[model samples]
Target: MIIVALDPPQNVDVEKWIKIRYDELKEYVQGFKIGVPAIIRVGLEGLSKIFKDYSGLLIADLKLADIGDVMALTASIVGDYGFNAVIAHAFVGYSQAVDELSKTCEKKGLKLILVVSMSHRGSEEFIDKHLESFVEIAKRVGSWGLVAPATRPLIIKRVRELIGSEVKILSPGIGVQGAEPGTAICYGADYEIVGRAITHSENVKQSALKIIENQKQRVAKCRG
Candidate 1:
């Protein structure tokens, strides 16, 4: 499964890239990641419109990190807004944040993917040391799965071992980061996230097709 991050486009003319991508290749990717930039730029009305048009999964990568009540409320709002999943920071409020968000999402029957490790050089130090703590929290909170950078496949495997198979892994490090989506799946990624690789490609549909093909190859290899 590929969750393409439909980040804000550079030029005003490129602003319609999310709708265009969704229109062109919704079948290739499992869902579309609607982050802060897209919501801010397109607004709720625009987002609702997009959701109506695109009949695929929607992940609101809002990275909610605040008090438990506030975080839960925000997550509930996103779920009510028709997002299939929402992103929350693991280290923000830890168990409290996860617990509240998980409860609300479960009540609404939505998935909550925790941001265990982000795809940036700046996040190395803390994630390196406190990974176990995050895993422990994940176990306690009863989340649907976790979202980590696919760049660290070994770490993802380790985290999965600690948490168990029931907790799915959503990884993002393909395309722009040069990590092959198939390799990530082979390393235990249930859902591979490819951002700029498909969304920013000269041909969005082709880029998405390549990723879906990669996913199929990986599944075949695993079966073999």
Candidate 2:
């Protein structure tokens, strides 16, 4: 599945732009990822309005890393905004914050996707070292999915091996971040979170279609 990360520019009409993107690519991609930039620009209430009729998966990339109480409240807010799922940080540890987020997400009918590892260079400094621990936390909390980086296919492969198939993996860092389309899926990711590539393209629908086709070819080759 290809999940478009809608990080619109602060100067444009965030809601309208999101709606346009959604309408254009909804048929091709499986879902949308709303990151902090868009949320901060339009707020959750605005998101509620924009996605009021959207039936596809809507994920709030909040990356919640606060205390248990705060995380729970945030998850509730995201749910109230009509988000289907939410992303949280797994480095926050297992028993408290992550656990509360998981429970709250479940109560609110939202899938909790934890960020086990990141896609940037700095992530290698710390997050990469604790990859196993993060995976363990996700398993213990019974998280619905995990955020792995597409930039590092080996990391996605290792994460898939550790978690097996019970939990899903969502990978970012495609396109602008340098990972080719389908690179993550070829390794192990169930979904690729693409942002600028499609959003910045002149023809949104075509870019999305091209990406989907590329992913299909890669997956077929890997299986064969």
Candidate 3:
């Protein structure tokens, strides 16, 4: 599945920009990821209006990393805003924060996606060292998915091995971050979170379609 991250330029009208992109690529992609930029610009209500007609997964990339109560409250609000899934940091530990977030997500019927590792080089300094702990937390909490970086396909491969086939993996850092279109999927990611590349393209639909095609070919080759 291809999940588009709606990270448009600051100057553009975020709501309209997102609506246009949603309309263009909604059919080709499986879901849309709304990050801080768009959330700050138009707020949750605007997002609801934009995606009212969208039936696919709507993920709120809040990256929630606060205490249990704080994160739970924030996720409650996200669910109220019509988001079907949320992303939080697993480094927050297994007891209070992640456990609470998982419970709240279950109650709210929202998919809890934990960020196991990041795509940037700096992630190697800290997050990479605790991959096992992160995956364990996801399992303990029964998380719906985990976020790994597509830029590091080996990380995706290793994560798949650790988590196995039950929980899903969503990878970022595709286009602008330099990972090939379907590299993560071939390695085991269930979905690729792409921003910039398709959102910033002159022809959004074509870019999305091309990405889907590339993912299919790569997965076929990997299996064959």
| Top-TM-score candidate index | 3
Point out the higher-scoring one by lDDT: 2 or 3: 3
lDDT of 1 by residue, 1-224 (tens): 78788886666643476677778877666788888977888876677777775666688888888878888888778777778888888887565667888898888878888877776776687865677787787777887778877787787777777778888888888878867767667877788888888887899898788788877897788768
After superposition, candidate 1 runs with Cα above 4 Å error: 13-15, 53-55
Cα lDDT tens digits for candidate 2, 122-223? 999999999999999999989999999999999999999999998999999999999998889989999999999999899999988888888888888888
Full ranking by lDDT: 3, 2, 1
Q: Model 2, clash count?
A: 0
TM-score of 3: 0.98
Q: Write the per-residue lDDT of candidate 3 for residues 1-224, one digit (tens) a residue.
A: 89999988968877889999999988888999999878988999999888887889999999999999899999999899899999999999978889998999999999999999999999999999999999999999999999999999999999999999999999999899999888899899999999988999999999888888888898888889
Error at 44, model 2, angstroms:
1.3
Arranged by TM-score with the best first, the candidates are 3, 2, 1
| Between candidates 1 and 2, the TM-score winner | 2
Give the number of the best model, judged by lDDT: 3
lDDT of predicted model 2: 0.91
lDDT of 1: 0.78
